[model samples]
Target: MFGWRRRNRTGRKTGRSKKQQFKLDKESVLPNHFRCPISLDLMKDPVTLSSGITYDRESIEKWLEDGNFTCPVTNQVLRSFDRIPNHILRKMIQEWCQENQNSGVERIPTPKVPVTGTEVYEILSSIEASMKRLDQCGFLESLKKINKWGFESERNRKCIVDNGTATTLANAFVTFSSDDHHQSLESHNYNVLEEILSSLNWMFPLENDARKILGSKPSLNKLVLLMKRRDFLSTKNAILVVEELCYDQEFIEALVGIEEVQEVLVRFIKEPICHAITKASLMVIFSMVSSSNHDHERIKTQFAEMGLVTLVLNMLIDGEKHLNEIALGVFDRILDSKEGREAACGNDLTMPVLVKKILRVSELATEYSVSSIWKLSRIEKQSNEGRVLFEALQVGAFQKLVLLLQCGCGDSTKEKATQLLKLLNPYRAGLECIESSDFKNLKRSF
Candidate 1:
């Protein structure tokens, strides 16, 4: 009886071990066929099958929509919904569906919410508050103190290299230069004027105080002298300050106006600094006369007859790209004045050289070279200077136009170029030049 019982017990244990091994094999094999092609994740949530089939909720749906769907590993066609013939797999999916339903889980798409007027107002308010806090922060105060010291000690040379003072000075110079009130503040008490000049290198931590001082009329001459003595290297900053002083309506109405400022600026333009600052100063002077309410022909003619046009044109020929833009702007403004244009024409200085520069600029525009092209074209349009426009087309401007045409791109530059070309009648001269040149091969590359 004991021997018989031992045999039965051993047989039962062996049978149970075989059943466990079969279950493991089934689980491993099931995943190999059911893996998703896109993510290679174990297939769930509306799983499809092979044989042009789809099986959702144990119901066969025929002719599943055709796309790139296939087996992830073997890349076989998944044709029909009934392709997953494994009964265990179907039972498992049905069980999962029932569980999800019982748990009350519903998959709903999220709706997007749009911002209202109130939300927009709140956002802007937050930004303004943050900016106010940043403006009054301790670091800004330290920067102001350092720049004050730099300007007082005549350490302009060293201050430019020190990033903190340089940035502060740049901001202060731009702010003071743009403020009408600051120009008025300059004509106030001498002590206040001195303080303002000394602290010119510092950022204005107090915007209201700075604005008030700048708007007031102080001695601009004294400020200019101080800046010259300090050897401030930034010409752009210096020119802006000078512009504010030159164009101050109340200050211009006073005795010390464009006449006095012009003499000082012309001297500065002759100084050995970056050409851009000098060019900018020239533009400011031209703009002052052009936009002035005062009858400043005497001043304008004085500037034009002083060989200013020659100086500006020379700078345009050799100046860097940014300076080129300013030089072009100055030329355009000068041409706008009948007195200035007559003066330029009387000197026999208007055409060929200036026109050549415009043409060269047009060629550069095709390559999307610089922002200066738009300004240059604007000047070209205003001046009605067509000789150089024709000359530019004769010298391969048409080839650039053709190349741009093939690319089928439209921008301000291409549009301007096309308009300029139309005025010049490029087909007669420019088209001939292009046909004679090797532009045919170049166009093929496009």
Candidate 2:
């Protein structure tokens, strides 16, 4: 490689590197067939489809990934997913690059062969056998190999998944979850669990059968075991899986009935794991008792009895902006039920804390905070009207509501702020001076 000093002409050394100085000549155009039709660039790894159109392997793979099954150039429905490598063409390209070594074009490295479905099945068999006999070394080795293969390419990972390995791995994890497995947990098996989780993460948005296996009683027990272990990687991966399962309504109902699951999820928030785990824990809970769920009222009563109200109050006192938004969203749902309202009202910090969050965080957070105060105060007035309004006003809910409406917010949020403002207005006598600015428009709604 020639250094800049050697290529310099006008005394000072040129800043260009050898590759830049040797860039492919624009005048010496590349052969048209050598370029990928999609990227319009020289092909690195050429492969042909059943439609007889050739494309760079990476480009075609990406096109397929985006859910387009048609050949890009031919516009024909691809009869197969098979991408036969054009070895002859690749060799020709390599020879041409070598013949023009003076140019910046470098020969592309040989693309690694992706793991086939057959090889994936073979590895799955090894993992199953290793798990059956509790062979720590064998299991760890297989898990690491699975991770390596998955890391090679998204194609390889998809092949491993197509082989129905996700369910097998989940069942294996369930078997390893019992105290029987805990006897050997502190050794290599512990780290092996992380590897298993890594492999599972690669196959996420798991197939229906795999989700059924993971959402089962055995797997729920396994998640509880992992969370209780308090090992960072294990807990993080376990919660992520739990979060994924939360999307299924059936699983949400089943998970809500599991006190152990509820306890661990709440403890993660209370004790504070990493932000991701904490946020995921909250999301799981939110999914469990969201109003969209049929059993939301019953679930709300259950979580309120478990002190979810107190936990969120503590979180909002010091949590970051996004966490505050989620917590308040959960808080909004909690107050929908009579039990949640009572639980929130029992705490002295409840109204004041809701007021504190109103305009202090992100716009979404303010919406949640304002909606929560509106919910609680509206409900609490049935029993304790004096104290609810007193606390909200004392904490400056009135002033925050004025500014929130003036700054402009979502239509729903704007309506919520207006309603909350009306509720807190009568408590402040002679408030005529504050009506001319942002509140001028809101005064009509009030």
Worst 10 residues of 1 by lDDT: 437-446
Question: Where is model 2 more than 4 Å wrong at Cα?
Answer: 1-33, 49-53, 62-81, 88-107, 125-141, 175-194, 291-311, 336-367, 394-418, 430-446
Q: What TM value does model 1 have?
A: 0.40
lDDT (Cα, tens digit) per residue for candidate 2, span 236-315: 99888888778888788777766577788878877887998999999998887784667778888877888889889877
Quote the RMSD, in angstroms, for model 2. Answer: 7.9
Question: How high is the CA lDDT of each candidate model?
Answer: 0.44, 0.77
Candidate 1 residues 12-31, lDDT tens each?
A: 32333556666565455444
- Best model per lDDT: 2
